[model samples]
Target: MFDSLAEKLQATLSDVRSRGTLTEDDVNAAMREIRLALLEADVNFKVVKRFTNAVKERALGSDVIGQLNPGQQVVKIVNDELAELMGGESAELRFSSSPPTVILMAGLQGSGKTTATAKLARLLREQNRSSVAVAACDVYRPAAVEQLITVGARAGADVYERGTDADPVEIAKWARERAEREGKDVLIVDTAGRLHVDENLMKELAEIKRVTNPTNVLLVVDAMTGQDAVNVAEQFAEVVQFDGVVMSKLDGDARGGAALSVKSVTGKPILFASTGEKLDQFERFHPDRMAQRILGMGDVMTLIEKAESQFDETQAKELERKIRKSEFGLDDFLDQLRQVRRLGPLQSLLGMMPGLGGHQLRNLRVDEREFDRIQAIILSMTAEERRNPDIIKGSRRIRIARGSGTNVQAVKALIRQFGQMQRLMKSMQSGKMPDIGALMRQAR
Candidate 1:
């Protein structure tokens, strides 16, 4: 997820921010470092040149050169330019006024187009509450249709796939009609892709577009392909008029090239990003938030949004009540842990926190196995022990350890941590701040 680029940029910015005032030479030096970072990240050379020039012009302007905390001003300018370069604002999928808004999905073979189709369907269904139905028109690929069916079902979208024999155009047209007749809110047509951009691919896509008259035409590009993905998007732009891009494999160690360059190169914003393999991992791309994340400024808005989506009001209120009454036990803790796990990887969540981005995030190895061990240890405990951990003694500790396949020390550490958390909660409930220094001493 732009780890290399983020590290280099954050390091360069860290140095810039340390300076009290920035001279022309200082700005040039920082810009040179940034140029190198972007180039190394495989960003388009033209885009890199344009972006650097813009940042330099802004940094050298009168507003920043002699200003208080000039270095901070320079960093702000870079963040702004980076966000602007990545399409300033997030793009939204257009829906038709009529029923069954048609969305045509296009891409080259192995671009994760099929998977992205299902992911987008799931997102629209969950976020927009749309009755989504995905049409499997990728007949050329062997298992493309079946794959769409499997993933689409998991996404809770109706699959309107006419197996591999039917013409993709006909399937798309038929699927749209069916969706309209069935009163579906959306119909996503997943078109066939080729090994390379060929006449047949464009021709078939054009025919499908003509038939479906989609409200949106989304090009799914593999973000991990770096410059090649941008090139592919450029080619697609030349042949078909896509409304936006769906960047797949964004969770991979993508050098941050395609995601940064696609909008600039193809004149299309990336509407969605497929961050992981799971259908639910897809999310709308927000250029500002991404720029902030890359710059080591946490994206709290996105973090909060994730929490809101996973934890409903009733559950949150119940948890708060339990905490206030000192009734939050191992079972409540387990449930909370599971809810957080659903938000995504812990490392990713941490990366969204301010001061924990880039190198800091890379340095922290958040062992997901620890979570598994915690779950196992809690499950191994009796209901009574979970309700009141204080009841466990010497013999009970050893038995619980063996049952959980863990060591006594591990169980002890977990209980200690939980106790500290409870103490902190109790302090808050009593309208007093806990003694953090004392707690640190106790933990040690």
Candidate 2:
């Protein structure tokens, strides 16, 4: 998300960490570069100033200067202050004690409020509260209500949509009532957005708020909007007094300035970040993990969480048993591939690994097409041949190659790689944890 900024910050911190001692002059010089990086990343000027000042004050304090590994201590200070600037802790969605907790979604045109609404419903469903109702109040756009309906269907939630003829306030009120009657636990009202901030939009939103009496007002901001996002958030907060901010499009090459500045600018915590268009791509915000990501240290906790979510414990244990017995086959290999794919794109997964970003993986493109080819090759093998690859003689290899529509050499390469991977898995199963850095070095 903040790839460029992360790279720059990592380099700057590495340089500082390499030094034996840190002086005020050294800290000032580093802060100057960091300030420029933040400005270039489109962080709000005021937020950047405050952030740098906080970092500077802490860096020059007695705890850091002339201490052992002063450079590292200073970097730690920066990370801590950056996390504090964004909000020291994650904010949880506050459910009303009364039935049908109303959540008002507000944002500008194309800010992904509707999609986030569905994503939020899906998140709530994961918590075992499945009765979610989406109220579409965006009557300005012709298909806005329909879009919300479709999203609601995808999220397995009920939709409270009124036609274009109804006033938004009335629609919201009716939707709330319907949710209460239906025994829904939560009501999400997707409000309309304007091309630009104006009196009419604010008045309409205010009217909706008056009618719905939402328990939480969330401002959805596009991370790609950079510094301008802060102003938009502030404007919305002034009118609606939003409880929190949702930063969308963290999967893009967003410099992350909006994410860094929004909380400080709006005086609200960032509750969630939407990484992609997929329903499950949204993640709850964590200040410490975000701090690690911003410093290019890799978010190990988030990575582990993602892995745990995607990896099946039973399947993993079965695979371990197969590897221990030296019975790992092409079928197992295919299963592993699917598990890795489920985690996320291969590049993103690798990028989260320590020391595995930027040029380190410049040539590895693990797209669906590559997976398709591998799967086709595996599918062409007979069950017996897959179980015991040694049984595949020259004639069998030719038949398999023809079936897969690949050349003989490609088939041979796949077989060779599969054998090596099986051996590696066996070694790992035997308690030999391979050094990932060495593996990358070998790949290079």
Candidate 3:
């Protein structure tokens, strides 16, 4: 998600890791490059200065300067400082002792506030919050209430809307009463957003706050806005005073200045991030894991979490059994492919694995469209052909290609790749990949 910044920072850290020992001058030079990298990534100047100074002070301290692995020590210091700069630990939503803890969503009009409200509801559903209800208080924007209802429905949360004609504050109060009467555990108020923070906007938000008595007020910030987002958060804090930030569109080409600077600049933690447009693509922010990913170390914990959430244990076990027995067919393969697709973008998945540098990722040129193509090809085949791909010769390949609206060569290539994958699966029975030379030959 921190694509540009991660690229620059990973390259800088990779050099440090390659060096056996580091002199003070060496560290200073690296720090200068790091400073420039952060600045180029659009990180705040003040935040960058403070972050570099902290890293330098720790790197030059007794523990690291005389250490046997001084370079590694300095890298560790940077990772720690990066984590500290972006909120040391994850901040979760705090619920009230009373039932129906209210969460008020606030942000600029184009910052993806309503969508984030639905994403939050979806996350709460995963957290065992079944009795969640969303109230649409955004009366200003055209079809704003309808937008919230649609997304809220996708998130599996009941949406309360009194139409766009009703006053937003009364809509909020009415929804609160409805959720309380219905014994809901949580109520999220999607407040209206303005083009910019103004007295009128703040006044309406303040009135909603007074009526709803929200336990948590979350400002959805577009991470792609960079410095302007930090400024918006500061303005909101001065007026409405939100409890945390929900940084949306992390999957975009965001330089990541706001995420690093928001909490430090506005005294509010970033509670969650929306990595993709999917309703289920929301996640709680983890500074340490993000720092690891930024340094090209990968984030296996998040990978595992995605797997746990998307993969069905029974189905996964059956698929594993089929692979072990060499019974994995196009049907099983299609099922597995769909499951992997549920885990979000393929490039993002690969980036989470250890040692996959940004350069390698870029070089891979992994096409997400490949999944759709494979699915189409597999679906075009008959039951027998799918069960036993070996029998699919020239005529069958042509037929499948036409059915899938693809060329014969495309179908042939897919079959060839599938055969290679099956062979690799069979060889993995020994818990190790086949010899590199043999594997390369098979790949060819």
Candidate 4:
């Protein structure tokens, strides 16, 4: 999501890295560019000034200026400062020694708190919190309780709602009691939000906090709101004193101002972030990994984690066997596509890939509907036709194209792409990385 800033910072730092030696003036110039980039990306003014100053001091310090790779040292200093600016380490939700660890969700209207609550539950489930429960206390908004229940079901967490008519605080208390009685490991309370920060909203949330005595209060902030999100978080922090923030819609936020400024402005860590709309799209925020990503160094650890969680091991082994035997087909290609989709958006994955950012990422736009078309074309074919794509000649291609609502040319392109993928895998097996330069020349 730090697309613009990442691009600018990478370019500015790449110049420094190219130099064999560094002068103080060179470091100053780079820091100037970084400061501008952060401002352009809407990072908080005070935070930007402090961050740039820290980075400049480290960049021009004797330790870095005397180093064999002074330029690299400067880059490392920036990376370290970025991590520290964002709280340095990952912050996990603190649970109590007692049962039913309460997590109070707080945010403004249109902040996507309801959805973040569900995503948090799903994340907890991944961490072995099997008996997670959620209390839908957002009784002010219409259908808020029902929305929580629906999303809560998808997250595999039991939802307790005393209907919209009941007092939110009382409902939260009752839900906590019920969760404790039922032996739920965690109870997440979805609190109501208003269009603006108001006394009534604060009072309601404070009352809920007083009644439940939540272990963690997470403020859900929409990353797309940019600096406004930081302002809202600052106000919320003063009133409700949240433990951390959950940044939702980060995938859609190209500027990433909220993420970069939240910790600095509110003095709270970003505990979690929602990368997409899917329930599984949320994840624990790791500042170090995020700093790496923002600096165009890539987040290989996060990428590997996503792979370990979403990629099928048995299917991967089978696919390897198929590639070695030249048995990989359109069926396997489709399966691979689906598995990749499970890892979230393709563009987000590309950002996590080493040496792929800035202009390269901007040039590549992942169209999910293309996968639909490919699936349709494959499904329109017979079993034999899919097993052996060579048999699909002129008339067969036309028939498949019409059936799949695509042109015959599109069918031909799919086959060609599939063949290229098979060859690419075979090259990989030979311990050689096949270059996709030609394929990537086309933006589509």
Candidate 2 clash total? 0
Each model's total of backbone clashes: 0, 0, 0, 0
Model 4 ranges off by over 4 Å = 64-68, 299-444
Candidates in order, TM-scores: namely: 0.68, 0.67, 0.67, 0.68
Clashes of 1: 0
Answer with 1 or 2, whichever has the higher lDDT.
1
TM-score of 2: 0.67
**Candidate 1's residue-wise lDDT over 20-139, tens digit each?**
557899999999999999999999999999999999998998473211256666777888889998999888888899988999999988888888888888888888999999999988
TM-score of 1: 0.68
Across 1-444, the per-residue lDDT of candidate 2 in tens digits comes to 898888888888767765656899999999998999888888889988998998998888847322125666677777888889889888888988987899999999998899999999989888656589899899989999889899888998888887888999999989988988888999999988888778998999888898888999999988888877788998887777889988988888459989998888889999999999999999899987798888875543344456646554565567667778887787877776666566665554553332343334445554545566677777999998888777776988898889988767667767766666667777674422122323323322
Query: What does the lDDT read for residue 58 in candidate 2?
Result: 83
Ranking by TM-score: 1, 4, 3, 2
- Residue-level lDDT tens digits of model 3 in 30-81: 8999999888878889999999999988888846321124555676778888
lDDT of 4 by residue, 192-211 (tens): 88999999999999999998
- Top-down lDDT ranking: 1, 4, 3, 2
lDDT of 2 at 224: 87
CA lDDT of 436 in candidate 3?
Answer: 20
Q: Against the true structure, whose lDDT is highest?
A: 1
Q: Show pairs that collide, candidate 2.
A: none
